[model samples]
Target chain A: DTAVSQTPKYLVTQMGNDKSIKCEQNLGHDTMYWYKQDSKKFLKIMFSYNNKELIINETVPNRFSPKSPDKAHLNLHINSLELGDSAVYFCASSHSFGQRAYEQYFGPGTRLTVT
Target chain B: TQLLEQSPQFLSIQEGENLTVYCNSSSVFSSLQWYRQEPGEGPVLLVTVVTGGEVKKLKRLTFQFGDARKDSSLHITAAQPGDTGLYLCAGLKGSNYKLTFGKGTLLTVNP
Candidate 1:
């Protein structure tokens, strides 16, 4: 079974348009994260949710928002997408309290292209 | 902010060759992890080291944690084409769930 999965694996939109990417994990982890990988392949954290509670919000622009409806789902919504938003978005999950709490499982990334 | 810098951003070698990827940081970490990512997919965890001066071996791969817990390295022996992937090193600080990941070393193994 695919432990972590993301929907809309490829998203192509024009500038000023809005889009959303959905992510789901069956690993039963308490924490879920959203990451952005730029063209230079630098991966940076965007947001993190623990049991549907916002825990970490990096200095990302307000145009990007992350919502977790439950422990298994986390979604990212982008408003007024710009060319700089063209990159890959990845979803990850991990336990919040345990010996292996730091170990994260990532899903197939969603490639976003903002024209 | 804690940062992990990886050297030799990219490396291409023939099969049966060995290589080493280094990840260094000025800040100490409570735990360090290494991950491998292939094209069109997310990264997959390869191993985690918690203790300083610890070493773990996975088949032909050897991972070592610096004695000061501020750095780590991954060495592959007789690398094969299957070993071609982007290697990432991540560090976790005390009580912080956030993982600081390195820029990654891209390895390409040719047959």
Candidate 2:
């Protein structure tokens, strides 16, 4: 079984179009995160949630918003997307505190291309 | 902002060879982690080094954390073609609950 999963493995949309990506985890972890991997392969943390509460927001633009309805699910919504939004989005999960708290499990990334 | 810089942004080596990739930072990290990512997939954790000067080995892979806790390294011995992937180093500082990642080192192991 997949520990962490994402929908719409590949997305192609036009500029100015809004889109949303969904992520879910079954690892029974309390912390979840959203990351963006650019063309240069630099992975950056965009947001994190612990027990469904927002924990970290890395100065991302207002267009990108993350919502966690429950600890197991975290979704990302982008408004008025632009060309710069094209990148691979990844979802990850981990325990809040413990020996393995620092270890994260990531899902197969969703590649979004805005043209 | 805390940043981790990885050396030799790209490396191509042949099987049965040895290679080492370094991860350095100006700020100290409470813990450091190394992850390997394959094409079209998210990174997989290879090792995590928390204590200074700690060394952990995974089969043919060896990971070390600098005594200053500001750097780390991953060494692979007799690398195989299956070892090719993008290696990433991430650092967690204090109690921020976030990781600062380096650009990454892309390794291509040719048979």
Q: What would the TM-scores of all predictions be? A: 0.98, 0.98
Candidate 2, residue A77: the lDDT equals 98
DockQ of 2: 0.88
Q: Per-residue alpha-carbon lDDT of model 2 for A26-83, expressed as tens digits?
A: 9999999999999999999999999989999988999999999999999999999999
Tens digit per residue, CA lDDT, model 1, B1-111: 539999889999999999999999999999999999999999999999999999999999999999999999999999999999999999999976799999999999999
C-alpha RMSD of each candidate structure in angstroms: 0.9, 0.9
Q: Count the backbone clashes (under 3 Å) in each candidate.
A: 0, 0
The DockQ-derived docking category for candidate 1 is: high
Show where candidate 2 strays beyond 4 Å.
none
lDDT of 2 by residue, B9-100 (tens): 99999999999999999999999999999999999999889999999999999999999999999999999999999999999987778988
- Local error of candidate 2 at residue A38 (angstroms): 0.3
* Model 2 residue B22 distance off true place after TM-score fit, in angstroms: 0.2
Candidate 1 residue-wise lDDT, A1-115, digit = tens? 9999999999999999999999999998999999999987888989999989999999999999999999999999999999999999999999989788869899999999998
